[model samples]
Target: MAQRFGGKYSPSGQKPEKGTPSAGPMNTARVTPVGLRANLMFVPAGVLLLSSVFSGAGAMALGLIGAGVWTGGAVMLREGLKAEAAYNDRKVARRPALPRKILAAVLAAVGAALAALSAGSEPLLTPLYALAVGGLHLAAFGMDPLKNKGTEGLDAFQSSRVARIVDEAEAHLASMADAVKRARDRQVEARVEQFQATVRTMARTVEEDPRDLTAARKYLTVYLLGARDATVKFADIYARSQDAQARADYLALLDDLQSNFATKTETLLIEDRSDLGIEIDVLRERLEREGVHLDRNL
Candidate 1:
């Protein structure tokens, strides 16, 4: 049965069976500084909970509140870092309007103050301790972006439209990612990641030229939505049956989508260059008509 459609003789061959985990670094979870900082909250949370055990009701309540607030702040800081990474990846981007890192630092400091008060610290020293903690937090993680980036001379309406489309495309990618997790196939996960990278390339191209959004709207929205639905369906089927053929076909689809997206992005970049050339030629003609003689090098 595996030989049908030249499956047994396919140039690429059959999919590898699930076996012991690979030792390759690619299989390992990425450990970022932000993730480590977020995880550190657990230690303080545990300490606060343990200290609460030996204290009165008021102290216990305050300690618990502090622990919860600290955890929330850590989560917020992690999200802010992730957002910052995404913003940095693009050639053009806007700063996050809310300063999440700053807010998180403030929350952590307030939590520290509450814990100090619970421990019966001197009232006058509590604020100082809180201020010190907050300062350290801000110094360590830094603040979120304070200004808009790469948005000079762009129309507000068009920029907003691009943002809306990109947001929707990102949601589709997220859905595809979540669905693929259910499949539990490393190859499939890698394939999805490849497709996502290509998709993001197209997205960045559109962002660099909002006019391209009209051309790319279907690819970003309709095609991505379809891919997400297909991934969800494929994950369900493969999870139950471990169907090799289905996996191969899905991977092939991803390859096609990736190729198309990459091609489209290249085309858009070429168009941008063409437009620049036309602008240069127009300026040169205008200078010539004005009887302004200039050196060829100039």
Candidate 2:
């Protein structure tokens, strides 16, 4: 995880020539909910399945059912966490429609109850086991967001439009990232990351002020669609032939696209500041007309 640091005067810090090999391996890290806690849920499921082979017909049936439910609950919980992370990352997002985490908790509870019953636990204790398992699962993973975030006081129609456009833009970026992985070139991947960061900055700006969506829609959609297509095509060629010219051309395209996107985002910000200043001026003039003199600093 040690990051490379370089500067203008550093001997080893110079940018490598386009056709040269990069120093590090391709970083393919991704976010997922498969940590220790999530993995542990599979243990009980595995135990049930393993024990079932040694049991009678009815007990084996019960054990298999319990194991299946437990495995399903674990998988659902992983998906729920992934969905929640995506929801939190967005400034404008609706609550998940399915509430996967809650359903996962219910499944965990039922699985626990069935497992306990299959093992001949006391009748009264089976429901307690269910409650404990469900409660623990809820405590660990938490429930899905029950309501939309960052949508208050906005025009719903405009917000929805922005959301749809942002979603499409995100899809393009994801496609670009996926395509670049095929090239297996670290430098190209890093270049793609920089371009993606620039694109996301524009996306965030439009999300913050949906009015800019009108001006930025083409960059978000048409240009991004072209970029994605170009990336896919470039990846196909470079991955097959390791074409130096193709790599250089693709990197140049990214450089051009990143610069344009950054400039557009900056312009949007300046315009937003201008609009704020105009509103303040209008309000100040109205106050002066009402015989309310204000200090220059005020």
Candidate 3:
């Protein structure tokens, strides 16, 4: 009798052909207001450079200096925006140590002042142009984060430990991605990305409850490092041979790792919920003992 094809043993989704990897649409679109502004800055920078060609030595030097300072400001603004995005994504985060936006504004104002002075503008006009440019820049980009988020009353030592572990884990993930790129196989890339998603799930769970760090330390450190090394070795081997059996084995290993990571994250969440329930029960008992009747209906 022939075995039926629709059960646990069967492939669940549309499977790709052997040795052919599935590819998804790339997410190339991004919201980059700072980046757009930075690009637009090149227009003014080019104008300054052109102006320098027709001016005296003093003016030429000042024009070049102005262009350099303005360019630096644009670069700083872009980095500040990126840092802001990362800060916003986390439940707990530290504000950027340096105020990049403010510094950029200062640099832009100084650049404008230098240019005005070089062009033989009246002293009064030079200061006015500088102040106007600086004020406009401040208005356009606003300010950097001034306060830490969700860090009140938390244990500082524990938070720092969690941050260190997460940073190391992120490095491992980045290394894996870099190694996999050398293999030039879409399927391998997809396999790595799927595993990364599982890793991120676990990371988020830990972030929600830093107490879970004790339970998840090995998974975050040792296992991730091992995976990174394996990815590097696989990329080297596959680049030269493209061995089908090796590729299959690597992919199967990724599947197992992803499953385990996902399961561990779910377990941590369940435990957290159970702890919350116990706390609620204890609070209710205390309230009842104090003769405080709870109202079930509003």
Best by TM-score: 1
lDDT of 2 by residue, 1-298 (tens): 9988885457787766653434555443345655788778889999999998798888888899999999999999888888898788678787888999999999999999989888888989999999999999999989989999887887888988998898899899999999999999977888887788788889888887889999999999999999999999999999999998999898888888888999999999999999999998888899999999788696
Return the lDDT, model 3, position 35: 65
Point out the higher-scoring one by lDDT: 1 or 3.
1
Candidate 1 lDDT, tens digit per residue, 1-298?
5654533357866644332223355532323536676678567867887898789999999999998888888888888887777677667678887778888899889989989988999999999999999999899888888776677888878987997899899899989989999999977887787688789889988988898988899999999999999999999999999998888788877877877888888988999999998988889889999998667686
Candidate 2 global lDDT? 0.88
Clashes of each: 0, 0, 0
Worst 10 residues of 3 by lDDT: 21-30
Report residue 75 deviation for candidate 3 (angstroms). Answer: 2.2
Question: For each candidate, what is the lDDT?
Answer: 0.83, 0.88, 0.82
Q: How many Å off is the CA of 123 in candidate 3?
A: 2.9
Error of 3 at 53 (Å): 4.7
List all candidate RMSDs to the true structure.
5.0, 4.7, 5.9
Q: Estimate the lDDT of model 1.
A: 0.83
Residue 250, candidate 2: alpha-carbon lDDT: 88
For each candidate, what TM-score against the reference?
0.86, 0.85, 0.80
Q: Which parts of model 1 are misplaced by more than 4 Å?
A: 1-33, 294-298
Q: Which candidate has the top score in lDDT?
A: 2
